[model samples]
Target: MRSLKILLLSSAFNGLTQRAWLDLRQAGHDPSVVLFTDEITVCRQVEASGADLVICPFLKDRVPEQLWNHPQRPVVIIHPGIVGDRGASALDWAITRQVNRWGVTALQAVEEMDAGPIWSTCEFYMPADVRKSELYNGPVSDAAIVCIRDVVEKFATGFVPVPLDYTQPGVIGRLQPNMTQADRTFSWFDCAAFIKRSIDAADGQPGVLASLLGGQYYLYDAHLDSRQGTPGETLAVQDDAVLVAAGDHSLWIGSLKRKAQAGQETFKLPARHVLAEQLAGVPVLDSSIAQQRFNALAYQPIRYRETDHVGELTFEFYNGAMSTEQCQRLVAALRWAKARDTQVLLIKGGRGSFSNGVHLNVIQAAKVPGLEAWANIQAIDDVCQELLTARQLVISGLTGSAGAGGVMLALAADIVLAREGIVLNPHYKTMGLYGSEYWTYSLPRAAGSEVAHKLTEECLPISAVQAMEYAMVQDIGPRCPHTFDLWLSQQAQSALTNPQYRDARARKAMLDIQQIERCREHELAQMQLDMVQNRQQFAEKCRNFVFKRKTCQTPQRLIAPWALTYEAGMPESRMLNG
Candidate 1:
């Protein structure tokens, strides 16, 4: 295919857009991507881009006719559902309905949204009990790639798309209205899975509402609970969560937001922590304090299981943020797992995200943000240190996206395996922190010095397929999690059967130890110095980013620095907006 300039536009720079950008660029297309910042001026910028095709993947708003009907340009919007499924809540509705199959559709941007002529479509079976974000990022992304590549390839050949036909027997989808809180609402009569599906549908934002604790609150981050209790009662309180009763079973809610009154500002917080005042009489059953007493409420954030001599440690944290306490607990778990008789260690991260490094939310909420940030990184360092110096054969199995310090943590393992469609953001400069977790050591070792420099400095997300080349990902597993887990287990069992397994394990462990020894001291020193003597206001930057208060334009380093200049008498810092 001839190289065509493609401008990738989306609602925001999310996991899906990041994945599409990398895939399109790698396919030899000259792709320029931008977020829809709700700016009218951006339309002029789109025209100025001189792109042959404009691809809008997961757009909240319809593409303007001016841009779509350009003389030589083609505008395609990637819809998250089937051909005729027109709405903003495609994935949310699918998860809520528990449909067996879901898909991505690409169509021309016409007057009617999602009623445009169809370009391409790809279907995927919906996974069991997965969150909306996970479904969107994983299966939806992979299918979108197929749908995207097809449209681009056909467009290059001047192939015209077929218009929508309501009478067509093959067309199955119809309009689905935007799912509201009322639509997702359920009572105590509903089973655990039904309630969970509702929560997962609204996982990322605008959680499902339920009247509880003598008031109304929207719930998020729910887990299946085994223990039974009186229907609609708060049975127990665990670390930052509450086990609330359902009809058939119970659910452990990790996070929620109290419905705001007339003028109150509401924020999503850890469930139990926010409701501490309301649950005054309820027993607090944190893992550290009363693990045995509240064994039913005791949720292990990290757990280890062995089968066929393979020790699999699964760490499924919410949004992949590793708080200081979470990291310390994970370290203890890792140490205990390492002593097990298993020959291979498989580190499985979360369903939504593999990891995104230290908990920015926790750090930002601290009394002293800088000191808290320092302590959290140090805590994670212990977890990574165990990975670096481990004697067992370690392989990081990433079923979901990973970023920043998490990327480096994956690299610390002897081998990294990821599902086909996962994305990776492996840079720290975005947060303005000289990151710990032996990144300076792991990154270069995995991708070499030059690629390492470009990756960190560019601060771009890479697709798993592209990541295989640059990030040195050892293997790309099955696209489906069910098949992926089966295949992964088989591989671990196969490794046990290898007569040379002992020799291989020893060889890899020795090499990693030698590499760590060479740079650990120097890297630690630089990180400490950068943190303690933060002349660049690193903590302030982190705080702003966490709070979504970043207002500065793109730094000069990314674009032409000469185009921006300070006023002669004003400060150089005033040069941010030319």
Candidate 2:
């Protein structure tokens, strides 16, 4: 198909939107983004874009009638629902309702949200016990991409879309109301499945509110446990997660957000940290002892296992935001893995997100946010240092999207392998951070000075394919998590016998440790000014992130190309479509 001008309108440049943008651009389409600000601004930007197609991949706001009624341009909404389905809480309701199948629909925008003529649709099996965000990021996103590609193909062929028809087979979806706190609420007295499903349905958004220790709190990031205790009572604490007993079994609550009281602000934090005072008397589950006593299902963010000549160290931090304690724990794990007899070390990140740097919610909730921020950055730097000087050949498996220091942390490995379709944001300007995961050492070393500079200064997200083009990553793996795991294992095993890889490892060991140390110190010094001194208002930005404050307008960098035209008061004479 000939290259077409496309305008992507989204509430935020979220994972799905970023993926869609990257896919379209890589497919040779001219695409630009316009974040939702307000009805007037959105309409104005749509008019000014003059795009041949408008794709709202991840929008929350309604499409303005002005643009939908326009004769020349066609507006498509990538709804995370099947045909005949409509609503904002589609995923949440699906998870809560335990639907066996779910899908994504690409349809024309109309006055009614998610109720329009369907351009294309793709369905997939709904995996059991998946969180709402995970469901969206995994199968739903994949299906949406499939539908999007089909939409583009059909549009190019001038094919007409079919209107929603109830009589059509496989059109079983219906409108679901916006989920409420009451819909998500569940008691500890409820069965483990019920509680887990409820919490999973509300994961990452408006969390499930429940009464705990005489205080109201919102819960998130749950895992099942077999241990038994009094229902509704705290059993134990381990790795900042609290074990709470359910009717049938126990659940490990990884994070909690205290419901804000009058004149108070609250954000999500590790459950143990949020209820430190209340959990002071709770028995702590030692990971080392538990590893020997129980199965591998014990609640722990970081885990290590050796198979043959490969040692895999996996960490699944909540939302991939590592706190000071979490970072310190990972540092210990890296040290342990380095001391193992394994020939290769595979550092696999979580499925949700690899890592997004320090935990902003934890930093914002600290008594001294600056000091906490400083400690968090230093702790992560320690992990990178361990990887930089490791004896074993280090390989990072990025199974999910990562941003800021997280991108650099992965670069610390000898070979960085990123999953296809994962987005990597390698800059820290948005968070008002200089960043200190030894990025100054890792980024330029991996991708050369020019590419590194462009990545950091531009503050834009790059696709995994783009990262490989820039030499930021050594290879790209399959998008499927299971397939990627198998591929990563094969690669790790193969590297053990590859003379070229061994030679690379030898050269990496010969690097001047002094220069790397100096780079780290410089990065830390800059971070100190930003974090401790608040030179760039890191505190404000951190709060804005944790508090979910929306940006007043889309960043100029995102819509930079059209900014000049708008400034000059130029008419929209097919500026982009032409």
Which candidate tops TM-score?
2
Instruction: Tell me the alpha-carbon RMSD of every candidate.
Output: 5.4, 2.5
Candidate 1 Cα misplacement greater than 4 A, ranges = 261-266, 277-300, 494-578
- The lDDT of model 2 is 0.86
Write down the worst ten-residue block by lDDT for model 2.
287-296
Q: Evaluate residue 11 in candidate 2 and report its C-alpha lDDT on the 0 to 100 scale.
A: 95
| Reference-based TM-score, model 1 | 0.87
Q: Model 2, 1-578: lDDT tens per residue?
A: 89887788899988898888789888988578889988877777777765778888998888989888877788999999989989999999999989998899999998888888999999999998899888888999999999888988888889888999988886899988999997888878899879989999999988999988888999999999998888899999888898999998999999899898899878888999889889878898766422533245666578777789999888899888999998888888788778889888999886699999899988988899999999999999998899889888899999999999899999989988889888999999888988889888888887889888888999888999999888788789898888999999988888766674664566576778998999999999999999999989999999898888877787767763644355347554543332
TM-score against truth, every candidate: 0.87, 0.96
State, as a TM-score between 0 and 1, how close model 2 is to the true structure.
0.96
- Give stretches of model 2 more than 4 Å off: 262-264, 289-296, 499-503, 560-578
Error of 1 at 133 (Å): 1.4
Q: Write the per-residue lDDT of candidate 1 for residues 254-295, one digit (tens) a residue.
A: 887779899865666677657768898888764532132213
